[model samples]
Target: MSGKGALSGTEVATHNSRASCWIIVHGKVYDVTDFLDEHPGGSKIILKYAGKDATCEYEPIHPPNAISDNLPPEKCLGPVDMGTVKRVEIKITDQEKARLGRLQLRPPLDEILNLHDFEAIAKLVMPEKAWAYYSSAADDEITHRENHAAYHRIWFRPRILRDMTHVDWSTRILGHRSSMPVYITATALGKLGHPDGELNLTRAAAKHGVIQMIPTLASCSLDDLMDAAQPGQVQFLQLYVNKDRQVTRRIVQHAEKRGIKALFITVDAPQLGRREKDMRMKFDAEDPDEVTKSGGEVDRSQGAAKAITGFIDPGLSWKDIPWFKSITKMPLILKGVQCWEDALEAYDQNLAGVVLSNHGGRQLDFARSGIEVLVEVVEKFKEKRGITFPNPRFQLFVDGGVRRATDVLKAVALGATSVGIGRPFLYAFSAYGTEGVDKALQILHDEFEMNLRLIGAQTIADVVPSMVDATNIHSHVVAVPGDRLYDSNYESMQHARLRETTRAKM
Candidate 1:
C-alpha cells in the first residue's frame, strides 16, 4: 500500500462498503473509510463513490491536495497501476456539451477592454450554477444595486493645469506595499468557475505586486495558494469564525505561522443570506436544514454558500477580539465593520484596521454600500475618537461595487487606506483564467494612469477629500445614473436548466 505501481483498480474496488472504502484520486488510492463521517458534506456522497475513481467528484469541490493534506499516513494507499486499472468512462450529457459549446464561443481576451466586459463574457461562458452563485446577493438585491449606485453620487471635482507628466498610483495597504490602491478581495468556491481556483489570484497578485485576501471557503486549500506564491508576495487571510473556538484558534494560529500578513475577520454574515438565485440550485439530498420548497421558501439550491458555511459561528462578537489578539501577532482587522462607531471601537481596541463592508451586499438586504459608510465612519472617527483621517493607528478599508479606478480613487480620496475588488477578478478568472486576471490588472493600471492625471492628482496621496464633492455621497435619496454595463450583465431569475435528459421509453 505504501509503494507506487502495486495496487490494481480491481483490487481497490473490493473494499467498497460502509465497513471499508477505497477510492482513487489523481492516480493515488486513498482509504477514506474513517473519513466519511468527518466530511463536511456528510458521509453519503463518499459512500456513493466507494471503490471507484472519485477524482471527478472530488476535484470540483475540494482542492487538489485536500485528500493528501487531510488524510493521515498508512490510510494512504499508493498509486494505482494504470495498465491494470480499468478506465472509468464518463457519460457526457447533451446539456454539458451545449454548455461547453457556449464556453468555446467566448470573446477573445484582446477584445475584452474592461472589468464589465469580463463579467459579460463570464455570464455567457460559465455554467449556469456558477453564474448564479457568483452574481447573487441578498433578498430583493436593493443593497447590491445600491453598492454600485453609491459611487455615482460622488462626482469628481478634477483639478486642471497641474503638472501630470508621470503619475504614480502605487501606495501602501495596511503598511504593506502595493502597486495600486486596491487589493484582490476574497470570494468563495472559485473552482466552480475554473479548476485552478484562487491560484489565479495568487499568481496574478504576485506578478503585479498587488495583495490578495484569501477566503476561508476558497475552493483551493490555503496552503495550495500560498505555496503557489513567489517569496515575499503578501497575502491576507479573511476569517469566517468557526463555531468551535478551538477550530478558530487553530486556523488563526496556522495562518499566522504561514506568514499571513493580516487577519480580516468577517463581521457581517452572522447568518448567511437567502440569496434566492443561489437557493434555487441547492441540492435537497445533501441538505439537512433545507427549507420546504414552496413560494419564497429557503429551498436547498443555495449551492456552495450554504454547503460550506455550516462551520461559521453566529456567536462571534467583540468579546472574541482579545482572544484573537492573544493567539496571533498578525495584524487583526474587522472585515465587515458597517459604521464609524465600530471603526472607532476597533481603534479603541488597538486593532490594526477596519474594512467597511456589507459582505458585498450578500449578508443583509438594504445595507448601505461601504463607500457611503466610509463617509460617516471618517466623520465619526474625527469627532468621537479624536482620530483624524489617515490615522496611522487605525487604517480604514472599503469594498463593494467598485468597478473602476475612479471608484477606488473616490474611496482613497475620502479616507480608505485602500479598496478591495472581489467579483471583478473572479469574473476575470472565470472567463480567461490566470491571463484574464493579468489583463484585468492591466486594465486597472491603464485606468489608474489616465484617471490620476485627469483628476489633477500625480500620486495616490494627492487624492484628497477636496478633490471630490461627496456632499451627496451619504444622501441615499438622491438619484444617480445607473450602471448600464453591470445592469446588462445581470440576468433575471430563471430555473436552473437540467442537463438535456435522455430517457428510455418503457
Candidate 2:
C-alpha cells in the first residue's frame, strides 16, 4: 500500500480508512476531520480531495485572503485534486484581507457573524455607489443606521450560570426546520460577489441547515436555484414584482412547482427609492443597459451595479400580492413592510407572515429602521388586531440592520418570530465566497447558541419579551393618523381635491 506498484490500491484503501490525517498546502496544514460536517460546498468535494495535493484547486475555490496565515491552522484542510472537483474562487487580495479584517471582522471572528459586520464590510468591499445601493435608505439612510444602532438601545438582562451544558439553536420557519433562527435574505445579483452566484448560495444555505430566500431578480434562474437548494432545506422565494404580470405569475408558479414553501413578496418599492449613492455615481435606475455598458469588467467593487442592472424590475403592487396568493397554496410572506399599518393590513388580508424591513436601507433613505418598528408591528397584530393563526401561528420576520445574536434575540423578543440577514451574507460572499458565507452563518449560529444559554433560554421559543425591556425600545411618531400610513401620498392629494370640490359646491 506504500509503493508505486500499489498507488491505486493505496488510494482506494485510504478512502475507506477511519483514520483521519492532515494535508499541507502553500506552507500550511489543515485538519480535515472536523470540517467534514461543515463543508459549505459539500463533503464530497472535501472527501474527494482528502489526503491529496489540493492547493491549486482549493486556491481557486476561495477568496485569496480567506485562507491566509492569520486564519486558524486547523481551518485549513489540505489541498485536493481539481480534475474531479468544482473549483469556484473569486479573486481576493491580501490587502482586501487586511481591510476586511479591520473593517468587517469583529473581535474573535474575522468573517461576518452578524448584520452590522456585513454592512461595514460591504462598504469597504464595494464601490461607494454599490455600497450605497445595498446599504442606503430612501432619503437619508436614517432607518439604515437606526436599524443597527437601535439594537444597542435595547439592553438585555442576561442570567448567568443557569444551565449545566446542553443547548440547541435549531428552530423551524414555515414548517421547515433550521439549525438557527436566522436565514439568508434573498438579495439580487449575487454574481456580483462570486461567479457561482445564487447557485452557490443556495447550496451553501442548504448545507448549513438554514433557510435561503431566493430573490426574484437572482442572477441564476428559478429552476437552477431550486435545484441547487436541497429538499426540506427551507428555501423561500422573494418576489420583486416585475412589470410583466405574466413574468410575475411565472415566477410564482415556478416556486410552487419546485416546493418552495413561502412567497416573500417585497412591498416597499412601489417605485425604486432615491439612493444617493447610486444617484451620486450617476447610476441610471431606469436604464440598466447603460449602467452595464459603462461598468467595465466585473471586479469586486463595480460588479453589483452591473449585476443589479440585470435584475431590478420596477412594476409591482398590492394587487399582484393576492394574484400570487390565489395561484399558490404555499405560505406568502410580504417583505419590506416598515409600519404597523402595513403589518395590520397584511394580517387583514390573511397573509401568512410579514417581514418588517427597510430593504436593508437600500430602498428608502429616511425610512424608520425595521427593528424600530418590530415591537409595534407585533403588538398591533398579537394584541390590537387579535390576529392569530393555527398551531405555530402567524409569524413576523424582521431584517435590515440585524448584526448580532443579541440583535436577533432583541428582534425576537420584540415580536419578530424570526429574522432575515442580508448585507452580511453578501459581504461573506464577497470576502470568502461560499465558504466565507458558511463561516459567517456558523459564527452567527454559534453566537445565538451561546447567547441563548447565557440568557438561560433553552430554545428559540424561550427567547421572550421578558428577556427584553420593552419600555427602552425605540418608538417613532408617524405624521399621518390611523393605521394606514401607505395612504399618506394619496391623503394629501385627496385633501386638495376635496377642498377644490367643496369650493365648487359652495
Candidate 3:
C-alpha cells in the first residue's frame, strides 16, 4: 500500500460510472463505489467526480480524516501516479483571478489596527467559496447583525480621577491563566482559510496564554491539534454529539485523557441552519436526483453545514445532561445557553458554566445575542443566586461579535466570566497566519489599558456593572447607529441567482 503502486490517469479514467466509481483526492486513489450510497452529502456529488481528481472539491469543506474515517479500508485504492494523472483544468474567471491576486498584495500586519481590519482584508483575499462559507449566517441574518449591534446600545459610564497606573487584563478561564479576558471560540473547518487551519489557533493561543476551543468538525483531526499544543497550554473541546453514543463516548474520554481543561457541550444547533450563501456555491449540486434515490429526507440545499454536520445527534436534550457527566471529570459548560431559564437550569444541574451564545448566529436567525442573554442571566442570578457573577460555583460566559475590548469589558461588568471571539481570530490567521493573531492580541492589550483607565478600573475584577449602563441592551426594536465598519466589511446577504442552462454543443 505504501509502494509506487500508482495507477495512471488513463487507467483511473476508465471507471467513470456509478457502478464502478474511482476518484483521486490529494494524490490518493479511492474506489468510492460502495461508500457512495452511504455518503452523507449523497452519491451524485461524489459520482460527479467519478474517474477524476476531486482534491479541489474535497479540500475546503471536509476534514482531512473525513474520507478515511467514513470510507471502508477496502475502498482506498492505493496511491495515484501524479506524473500520469491529468490535471483538472478549471477555467479561472477574471473576478477569481483578481481575488487570488489580493493574497500577494495584503497590507503589512502592523497596519492592521483592529479585529475588523482582519475581516476586511480576509474578505478581499480569501477565495469565494471560503469567504461564502465563513461569512454566511442563518436565514435573513438578523441575529447575526444583532450580535454586534447589541453592543452599541450599552453606554460606558466612564469615571475620572483614578490612579491611572498599570492595568492588568490577564485572568483565568476555566481555572487556567489567560493573557486577556477572552477565549478564541470555536469555528469549524479552519483549513478553508489557511493551510494550517486550527493549528494556527493552537500556536497563537499557546504563544499568548489563551484557550482555543477545538471544534468537532475542524479540517485538522483531533490528534493533529492535540499533538500541536504546547505543554500545559489549556485547551477546550466543543462537542457536536454524534448519533453513535460510542463515538461520542470515545471522543469525550479521549479529550479528557488529552488533558482538555473543560467540555463545552454545544446545546444549540439541533439542526444546522439554511446558510444560503454556502448553499449557493453547492458542492453537491450535480446529484440532486440522489435525494429521491436514497429515500432519505436529506436537504442538499443547506450546503457545507448540512453535509459536514449530518452526524450530529439532534436528540440531545436535558436527559442527556447526566449522561455527559457520567462520561468525564472535565468541567461541563453548555456552549449555547440562550435564556435565563436555561442558565438557571444549568446552575441547578451542577454544570460548571454556560456560554451565552447562539452559535455565533449561524444556527437560528433572530436568536438574541449572547451579551443580551447575559443580561437576563445576571438579572436571574441577582434574583435567585443572590450573586452577580464571579460565582466560581457556576460561571457564565458570552461569545459572538466581540470585535473590541470595550465589548469584553461590558460583558465582564454584566456578570460574565469572560468573553469569546471566534470569527476575528479566524480572519486574523486567514489574512496573515499566526502573527495576525498575535497582533490582534496586542491591539486588544493596548485597548484594555486605555479603556480600563477611562472606565476607572485597574484590573478585570474592577470592571463592575456601574461602569457600563445597559438599560437598552434588550431593546430589540431600538434603532442604534449602524456599525459602519462591520457593515462596510460585511458581504451582504446573497440571494442565489438561477444558474444559466447549458446549450447543446454544435
Candidate 4:
C-alpha cells in the first residue's frame, strides 16, 4: 500500500451503500453515507458524485473546512487504500438540457420583455425593504412617474425606405468607443441583486462590449471590480462626496490607479431625498434592515449612510473640480445636471462631459426628465452658443426611464450623445444573473439596430437633430434667470476657494 502502484489513502474504503461515497482528508476515511441527510445543498447532487473521487467536485460545492467544522473528523474510519475510488460520468439527456434551458428562458421572458415587466418580479425576487429602497422616489413619487411618462410624450417619427443594410451602432465616448450608444449607469448594492453583484454586471458588459459605471456604494471593492473587468475594457467610477474629503480623494485616486476611464461626481444628492417607501418601512438610517435581511452586513466603506445621517459636508463646491483634476488625468463627468446653465458652466470648467440626469427621479420630485432637458441643452450648445470641444469632444449623456432601443435612438436623435441605463439592467440581474443581463443587452442592441434602419441612418454619428422631424416633436423649456446662473458659478468658485483653505488648515 505504500508503493506508488498501490492505493495508500482512503480511495480503497468500502461504502455500505453504492448510493453514497467516502472522502479522504488528513489520512482519514470518512463515510458520507448518513451525512447525506444533513447536507444543505440537497443530497441528490452529492449522491451523483458518490462511489468515486468526489474530492474535486466536493471542494467547490462545499469547502473542506465547512465539512470539517460541521462534521466530526472522528467520522473517518481509518487511512484506507486509495484505489477503491473511481470517477463517475453524469450524463445529461437532451430532455434534461431542454428543461433547464426552458427554466432559464422563462425568467427573462416573463420578467424582462418590457420595462414594466420586471417591477413586480423585482419586488417578488428581492427583499421587501431592498425593493422599496430601489423602486421608491423622493416625496410623492410624482417625478418617478414623470420620468416614465415623459418618454411617451416624445413620439418617434420613424422614417422608412432608406437603405440601411449595415448600420454602425458603435460610438465614441470619453475617447473610447463602445458597441452601443448606451452604457450601464451607476447603481448601488449590486450584491443585493445577486451574489456575484458588480462582478456579474462587469462580465455582462464586457461580453457585450459596453461600459459599466461602478457606483460609489458597490458591494465589491474598487480593486475587485478592476480585476473582474477584462483588460482595456472601459469602466467609469462614480463618486459621492461625503463629509470626509479624504475618503472621497482615496476613492478617486484608486479609480485613477486602477484605470477607470472617467470619474462621475453625482451632484444631485447634496442631501438624500425623502424616499417615502423606505420611510414607511421604518428603514433605520443608522442600520438599514435591508442589510441583514438581504443576507449580509452593510458596506459602509463608501460612507453612504453618513450622508443619509446628516454628516455630509455642505461646503462642497465646483471649485473643487481642479482638485479632482489634479488627482487624476481621467475625464470628470458631472451627473444629475438638469439645467442648460449648469450644462454651460460644466463646459466652461473644462470638465469632460455632463450627464443630463435627475438621479432617475429619486433625488428631486419636480425636476424635468433627463431627456427633456437634453434637447434644450444640446440646442443651446450647438445652435445657440455655437461651442464644441475638440478631439474627445464634449458629450451629453442622458438617463432615466430608458427601456427600449427606440428610446435610446430617440434620445440620440434628439441630442444625447450617449445614454445611461439604470433600472433595466438591475431588473435583468434580478431575473437572471449574468445571462439575464446579456439577454437584456442583446435585446436593446437589436432594437437599436432595427430603429436605426427604420430612421434611415446607418451610423450612430449620422443620428442628428436634422434626421428627426420637428413637426410632431412636442418640446418644453423652463428658463432660469441670468442671476441664478451667475449665483451657481459664484457658488462653484466659492467652494473651490474653500477647499484650498481647508487643505491649508489640514
Every model's TM-score = 0.87, 0.65, 0.91, 0.67
lDDT of 4 by residue, 432-460 (tens): 77877887888888787878888888998
Give the candidate number with the greatest TM-score.
Answer: 3
Task: For residue 251, give model 2's deviation from the true position in Å.
Answer: 1.4
**Where does the lowest 10-residue lDDT sum fall in candidate 4?**
489-498
lDDT of each: 0.85, 0.62, 0.86, 0.67
lDDT of 1 by residue, 385-501 (tens): 577776667888999999999999999999988999999999999999999999999999999999999999999989999999999987888888888998998777665566566
Can you write out model 3's per-residue Cα lDDT over 1-506, one digit (the tens) per residue? Answer: 12457788889988888778999998888998777766656676677788998998788778776787677788888887877777778888898789878888999987888889999999888877788889989888888889999999999998889897888889988788999999988899998898888999999899888889999889888888989999988999999888988989999999899888899989898888888777766643444665567543444567767767777888999999999899999999999999999999999999999999998888899899999999988888889878668788889999998999999999999988889999998899888888888898888889998899889998999988889889999889898988889999987776556767899899
Candidate 2 per-residue lDDT over residues 268-351, each given as its tens digit: 776555555444343222233432453322222232233233233465656666777777888888888888888777777788
Candidate 1: count of backbone clashes, pairs at least 3 residues apart or interchain: 4
Can you tell me which runs of candidate 3 are displaced by over 4 Å?
A: 4-13, 26-29, 34-45, 72-93, 283-298, 496-506
Candidate 4 root-mean-square deviation in Å:
16.3
TM-score of 4: 0.67
Worst 10 residues of 2 by lDDT: 487-496
